[model samples]
Target: MITITTADAIIHTLESPEAIADIPSPNTRAALQAAYDAGHWELYEPPQAEPEPLPPDWPAFRLALLQSASFRLWSEALPATWREDLKLAAIAANAEALQSIYTHCTTLHSPGHTAATEWQQVADHHRIPITF
Candidate 1:
């Protein structure tokens, strides 16, 4: 079994026939040619794909989101009743309330929305699943 590097080199040399002369070993060249003729170039094992990353730490994310300046500002800007309701929902860890908040922030183009978007992008880039 050849290493991945050797397999790649073989494939490259086969594809570029002129490069075959550069290969010092006659046996290696013959093997490469035979493999190519047999359409077995891909018979060599491929590199393993990277594993999918685990989801972000939900509790930590929630805490950070709740404590964010954007969230604070959004809450402060709400009417008295709505503000109280939002606080209660947050305390209760209501999923619907969180979704509602996200929707509202997005609709209003609030700073909270920007913060959420940034956080989401960062999470995606790090291969972390974003629950929110």
Candidate 2:
């Protein structure tokens, strides 16, 4: 009359010869042993929890956003050399220049302002700490 809640408990009970012998009914003892030997007890594993999603790769994401068509079009108003310099600064991870660019892009009534505003919302949603 073992109170079995899990497969581990069944395994523990099976390990004790004395406990098996103490079972007064031969049919019950044979059935328990048969169930163990047939591997039916292996099917009762506890459900595994899903792993949490990883955070975004912010540096890569920011760089990609900067390279997007909208950003490129916005920066086209600048001279060719300055546009190249901007790309280089982004590649070099110049935080000050990136912050300045973010501020400039998000200016009201500016070209590509809508795209910049959407980007700012994404940054906010991700709790990015960059100050503009």
Write the residue-wise lDDT of candidate 2 on 1-132 in tens digits.
222223335443343333656667897777666655555443334559999866545666566667567666667766666566656655666657766755554452265557666656655554554443
Per-residue error (Å), model 2, residue 66: 5.3
Clashing pairs in 2: none
lDDT, candidate 1, equals 0.55
> Candidate 1 — which pairs collide?
none
Global lDDT of each candidate: 0.55, 0.56
Worst 10 residues of 1 by lDDT: 1-10
For candidate 2, what is the lDDT?
Answer: 0.56
